[model samples]
Structure formats: structure tokens, C-alpha cells
Target: MHVTAILSHADEGGFTAFNPETGTATQGETLDEALANLREAVELYLEEFPMATRAAPFVTSFDVAVHA
Candidate 1:
């Protein structure tokens, strides 16, 4: 199964993650890195709490400019 992520930068030039489905977030460094780490984190989470899904990953990504 696959999930969605929303990544944003921190105040100090790092990264944070948001799982839209579960409304959870975490901090990381880069988007690629964050998604990589998030995948593992989600895996571990699901291992502890399983879900019902019998399909492969369906990932979608895009770039957006942030305004201050």
C-alpha cells in the first residue's frame, strides 16, 4: 500500500513531513530523504497497526513554491 506526503521546510532550513491520510508529521532534511525515511516509518507503524489494502504503491509527487 502507498500513502501521500506533504513536505515543507523548517525555520532553520530543514524539512517536515505531513501524512494527509493520518494527519501526522515529522521533520527531515530533504524531500527525497524525507520520503525515504517516511516510507520506513510508515512501514514500522503499519507493522504495529495493520491496515486493509492489497495493492502496490501509487505515489504522486509535484513541486510547489512556498511564499513567505
Candidate 2:
């Protein structure tokens, strides 16, 4: 099954990955490791509760104005 992965750089170090489908999140020192961890987490989640069809998440950006 195809799933969306959102990866971001952690504040302290390394990378963080999150799967929207199952709301599974994980972190690793490298991009590859982060993705791998996310994949493993999603797999484990799916094994317990499988999904028939996961709707693709719409990703967009919004901005908020700040006043000084």
C-alpha cells in the first residue's frame, strides 16, 4: 500500500518522519533511517488494523501574519 510520509529536520538533530494514513510517527538520525523507521511503524499499525482504501492527504501551506 502507498502511504504519504512527511519528513522534517529535528530541532536537536536527525530527522523525523510521520505517516498521515495511520498517524504513525518515527525518527532517525538520517533520512533513510527515518523513512525506514516510519515504514516499519506503518507496517506494524496496518498488521493490527488494515485499511481498505486510504485517501490521499492534501498538503498545502498557509501563512500567518505577525505584527511587531
Candidate 3:
């Protein structure tokens, strides 16, 4: 099944990966490793609690105004 992954830089080090579809998260030293870890985590979650058919997530970004 196809899923969405959101990655971000960790404060301590490395990267953190998150899968919104399954609400799974993992961390790794690199982007590739983070994705791999996220994949494995999502697989395990699905094995235990399978999900029904759903549409793919629409990812976008918006700007917010910052006041000084």
C-alpha cells in the first residue's frame, strides 16, 4: 500500500520520519534510513491493525505572518 512520509531534522541529530496515514514515526541518521525505518514501522502497525481503503493525503504548505 502507498503511504505518505513527512521528514524533519531532529534537534539532537539525524532526522525524524513520520507517516500520517498510520500515525507511525521513526528516526534515522539519514533520509534514506529514516524512510526505511518509517516503512518498517508502518508495516508492523498495519499487520496489527489493518486500515480500510482511503484516498492519498494531499500535502501542501502555507505561510504564516510573524510579528516582531
Query: Which candidate has the highest TM-score of all?
Result: 3
The parts of candidate 1 lying over 4 Å away from their true place are 54-68
Candidates sorted by TM-score, descending order?
A: 3, 2, 1
The lowest-lDDT stretch of 10 consecutive residues in candidate 1 is 19-28
| 1-68: candidate 2 lDDT, tens digit per residue | 77899999999899999998788999999999999999999999999999997566678779999999
TM-score of 1: 0.65
> What TM-score does each of the candidates earn?
0.65, 0.81, 0.90
Stretches of model 2 off by over 4 angstroms after superposition: none
Query: Which order, best to worst by lDDT?
Result: 3, 2, 1
Q: Report the C-alpha lDDT of model 1 over 1-68, residue by residue, as the tens digit.
A: 76777788889877877776555667778888877777777777778888787565566778999999
Off by over 4 Å in 3: none
Model 3, span 1-68: residue lDDT tens: 77899999999999999998888999999999999999999999999999987877789989999999
Estimate every model's Cα lDDT from 0 to 1. 0.75, 0.92, 0.93
| Alpha-carbon deviation at 45 in model 1, angstroms | 0.3
CA lDDT, candidate 2, residue 12 = 88
TM-score of structure candidate 3? 0.90
Lowest summed lDDT window (length 10), candidate 3: 52-61
